[model samples]
Target chain A: MAFRVVHYINQFFANVGGEEMAHIAPELREGKVGPGMAFETAWKGEAVIVNTIVCGDSYFAEHEKDAKEQVVAWVKEINPDMFIAGPAFNAGRYGYACANIALEVKTQLGIPVLTGMYEENPGADLKDKILITPTANSAAGMRKAAPTMAKLALKLMKGEVLGASCEEGYMPNGIRVNFFEKERGAKRAVKMLINKINGKAFTTEFPMPNFDRVEPGKAIPDMSKVVLGLATSGGIVSKGNPDHIEASSASHYGEYDIEGWDALTAEGWETAHGGYDPVYANENPNRVMPIDVLRQMEKEGKIGKLHRYFYSTVGNGTAVASSRKFAEEYAQKMLKAGVQACIMTST
Target chain B: MVKEIERVGIPVVHMCTITPISLTVGANRIIPTIAIPYPLGNPALTPEDEYALRYKLVDAAIKAFSVDIDKQTVFEF
Candidate 1:
């Protein structure tokens, strides 16, 4: 039987227009949009992209959960055997939206979800778990990626064993594929290196896309009476990470006040950051949150004052969106407290 | 924190142990600390030695507030 496929697209790709039209709500339609049509026409199997549902990046980011649910509900009715979204080049928001929808569908509906992105989009960070195709930053890479993604999608839908992480150009789906490979990782790496040395084109065994580096802000002014705020991801907590910050994948953050105390003790403090070895911090609270030293300075009148509260959150694989939100809010809180300086510590 | 705070137009200074990691990370206006694990103090040293090191580093870090540089600069112990 011919497999049914659904192609997800954004407002721009659906030919709906640009940012102004991004608020276009989720609606279903018969058959594929621009790229979806290309996929259907180019696919090997008798797989037809049954529908293309278009939504804007602004709309999706503004209404993430609703957008996911709506898309899922639509796909449920269409009942696609496989789903594909994007060849989302460097469009961060669009790539994120497609990745989110694809990830949701695969996890909830038990279907294969495939997407593509340039090496620089942060969508790769979140959706590296999905069958994300390796793509160049422009439409130039579209021809190569579409067919590769289509072929892989068809194979996955047919329950064929996909190749190892190194052989496949897609990001590691985090799904372990047990295969009796003729060569192990080291052997394959050497072969690829040799190929490249011989003037033959060779791709990385594990292709990790690049990330856009945010320019660090410039240093603050010099002032005699300024309060410095402290933040740590070393998992310093009061007795317990009472906030239930995941020992490895923490998403929750907590802030506490130390207006009167000279030091934080391990008797009531613990480490919540999962990314680091917590042994030193667990045995002695001062190892991570040096509230004691900061306290001494306060008593000595070295600085004007301490921000009554110190902001904290775990930084281990936490989403960029969440981290930025935390940072913005924390900065605002410090501002409200009249804090002129900050000393955030991350593990 | 120094970078972010500075963005809001407040003066700031960064302090860290003299380590390759700190240098590579491009910290600006660094005040040298005693060690990596405990930047301000050495666990192996006597209490008086540790206190001296912490006081020296902290003093330098505090003093760094008055100094200004266009790019990254490290403070010697």
Candidate 2:
């Protein structure tokens, strides 16, 4: 059976006119339109675009819900084996409409959908949600886009497993795949080094990640009126360390309820922090987190209420990634509890 | 991790015996501890004196949060 496909293009490419014609509602034509003519040439007889659904960029953006439902209803009637959205380059509205409609088409119809857009396109953010072949920055690159989109759509129609992003020329979908290279690590490194020393460019197997530099948040105007929460990397826990967070390289953090409690004692809690000497912190755990003093402050009306629960994790030898994960999770929990400020203690 | 908490907007006064390392790690506010093992108190001091020292540390840290300023700050006891 010839693989049947449905193609989606914006008003401009569908010859519904340019920006002035962008108000056109989505309507299906019998067969290939505009870029689909190029796709037909590329696909040969392997696949045919049985229908072309065209929607105006502005109309689709302003009336997304109605536009999407209308388009999905039409596509459901056509029932193509695969769907293809725009090679929408850098056109923001058009790219957004293409990716948006393509995602719904795949979801409601459960067919493989492919799109193409410039790397910087806002629609590129949807690369993980649907297949998006990398395209040029404008419609001028439609020649390159058509063949790339057709090849991938053809693969999808035939149920062929797609290759890596670099190999297949698509945006990386963030799914990790294991593939052994012909050359061993040592050989590859030597070859890479030779190429680099010869002034030739070499692609690195692993790219360094850029870290976020967060600006400090505005300070609280009045501590007495705000809820205060306590978080610690000192590893002070309730008595036996219920969560069993390791003394070093802790795997998890524990949220202990401290409401109506004034002191942290050696009997009730101890230090799980391995980096520091345990005797003093264990004997008077409050010395580390200063919860006892905070209670005193609350009583003295120096601050509002202390948050009911305190989070504890051991920072000693703990991975940076693990600590970040702990903070991300517990931070949201504290925020939900109305904690406007936090006291983070470390050993 | 102090930097991480501060990054999220809640100001942190890192109470550590090692002040230089705290500043180096980009901790915005810092209060020096009496010792590494027991940051709040000096065990050699009498109970009353120790309480005074701990109170001084916590008071300084909390007070630091009250003041408004730009850039990193260090709170001394």
Candidate 3:
């Protein structure tokens, strides 16, 4: 007997209408519909889409509680071996609907669930909780997305153990699953080293965390009228280290008032950073925070005014997520204070 | 931290010893500094000279804010 599967899609893929029909509520249709056909082809008669649940993107977003209850009830009644919802691509609302519905089915009914979406979709925030195969930013990627989802779905239905996210083509979900490699660790390391030394392309087993590149903000039109803010990951603070920012892996940042200060005298300020020798920064805190030069610039009209407060934190061994959160908090303060530009120093 | 500040639409220049690390972390504006321990100052120099060097670097960083750039840029001083 063919393994039974339940598929989910939005109104756009269901041919119910475009944005005009996106308000339509959840409905069940027997067998594959729209992109389900692509999955059907990939399944190769090994499994059949026993049912498909279609929901409007807007309806799902507006009535999430009601929609989830309906979808879970329908899935329970059908009781398919596996559940799949959307290769939603870049559609934000649809991706949300698919990821959420898939999560609900897995948790509420204990069914294996799978979905796909573009990495930037807000729904991808749930990637760590669900199996999300990355797709291109548009529905044109359906051809590739469907097959990848189907292959993973089939394995999931067969109750087979899964491999690492990289090997299985799913987003890294923070769970480290170990598997045997064809080559031993020592041999693999040697081969990689040789490839690197020879300048040959070789994929690293552990890649650096991918950073999102932000477009440069438009340049300040005139420096003469700008309120220049100063910030640092160099850990310069008051001589006493009032907020007690950690020397390494900082948990918090300090905001100091230098409103009337001209230079950071050795007696007045010091570095909280443990990553480097603190002698120079301690002798002259200006080395790491540059308040002395910025004050001079303010007086010399090189800049309009120096922001009164400076934010400081130690960057040594700090997690990128923590760093981002600290900056997000202080960046809002800078913005609210009418800071036009900023210079950040790191040690 | 520099990237996050710039992401909020505020122009920010990162002054650090390792420009490559700054580039990798997606900082849009970068200024190479003397060393990790004293990014804006040089203890070997006379106080006046070290002060001058720090001033020059800060000036360069300020200038970076007014120059439009489409990609990550290292502002050399």
Candidate 4:
């Protein structure tokens, strides 16, 4: 008997009217709707989409809680072996609905779920919570997305352990999965180095996340009136590390009071960062954060007052995503506190 | 992280030993520091000289806040 799979998609992919039909609510059809045919072909009798759940993008966006409840109820009734949602491409609302519905089914029904979308789709933000295969920016990529999704779906149905994101075609979700490679680490690195020197195209095993450049903020008009903020990834912290920030891959940041501090003494402060030699920084924590010098400038009226609080986190091996989250959270606080300028240090 | 702070409209200068990584990460204003272990201070110097060196670097970083830059820039010390 073929394994049962339940598929979800928005109205446009269900052969329902496009923008005009976007207000339609949730409905479940018997089997094998538009894109389901592609999954069927790829499944090759190993699994069959027993049911298809269709919801309009606008309806889901407007009535998200209700739409999700309805879809989850229907999926529970079907109780398929696995669930799949749209390769929603670049349609924002549809991608969001597909990713959310897939997440709901997986959590509520305890079933495996998969979805696909363009890498930049807002839905891709949920990639850490669900499996999302990257697709092209438009529906034209369906031919490729289908087979890739289907192969992974089949693996999930068979209860097989999955490989790394690069091996399995899913976005890197922060969860590191270990797997064996044919070549040893050193041998593979040497080959990659050779490829690089010869100008041959080579894929990096650890690719840096795409960084968005931000326009520089307007310059402060007068340094004497600016409230300077201090932050660091060099991991300077209170001597006891009261917040207990990890030495590497720090998951959180520490905010400390420096209202009257003139210097970071060896007994009062230390570096929690494991990436570098800690001796110098431990002897004078200001080497990493430079709070002492900033305080001197403040006293001399060279600059306005230093913000009383300093933020610290270890940058050693920290994920870019984690670092971004930390900064976003604190930047809002700094703004509210009237910080006009900031100095950030990293080791 | 420096970029994130800048994204929120706060002028920020990154002081670090590795200027290339700071540039790669899209910091707008950067100040190259002395070394990874002692970015602002040199233990080889007397405490007074070390404090002066750190004061100079921090001063440069403060200067970065007021400089108008259209692209990623390193504020040389």
Q: What is the TM-score of chain B alone in each candidate?
A: 0.75, 0.88, 0.95, 0.96
TM-score of each: 0.63, 0.62, 0.74, 0.81
DockQ of 4: 0.82
Residues A5-93 of candidate 3 have per-residue lDDT tens digits of 99999998999889999998999999899999998899899999989899999999999999999999999999899999999999999
RMSD in Å for all candidates: 6.5, 7.5, 5.1, 3.8
Candidate 1 residues A1-347, lDDT tens each? 77999888888888889988989888788887888866776774479888888888888999999999999999898888998889888898888987889999999998998889987788888655687887888767888888788888888888887896545668766777777768798899999989988999987746543322223334444434677777665557777667787765566668887777677766777777766556655765564556776667777777666778876776567765565566667777777778876654444
Interface RMSD of 3: 0.8
TM-score of candidate 4 versus the correct structure, residues matched by position: 0.81
lDDT of predicted model 3: 0.92
CAPRI-style grade of the A/B interface in model 1:
acceptable
Report the number of the highest-TM-score candidate.
Answer: 4
Error of 1 at A41 (Å): 8.0
The C-alpha stretches of model 4 lying farther than 4 A from their native spots are: A62-79, A180-202, A217-227, A242-260, A291-301, A304-309, A317-340, B7-10, B62-68
Q: Which prediction has more favorable TM-score, 1 or 3?
A: 3
Clashing residue pairs for model 4: none
Better of 1 and 3 by lDDT: 3
Instruction: Report backbone clashes per prediction.
Output: 10, 2, 0, 0
- Score residue A88 of candidate 2 by CA lDDT: 94
Worst 10 residues of 1 chain A by lDDT: A208-217
Residue-level lDDT of model 4, residues A5-75, one tens digit each, is 99998899998989999999999999889999999999899999999988999999999999989999988
DockQ versus reference, model 2 = 0.38
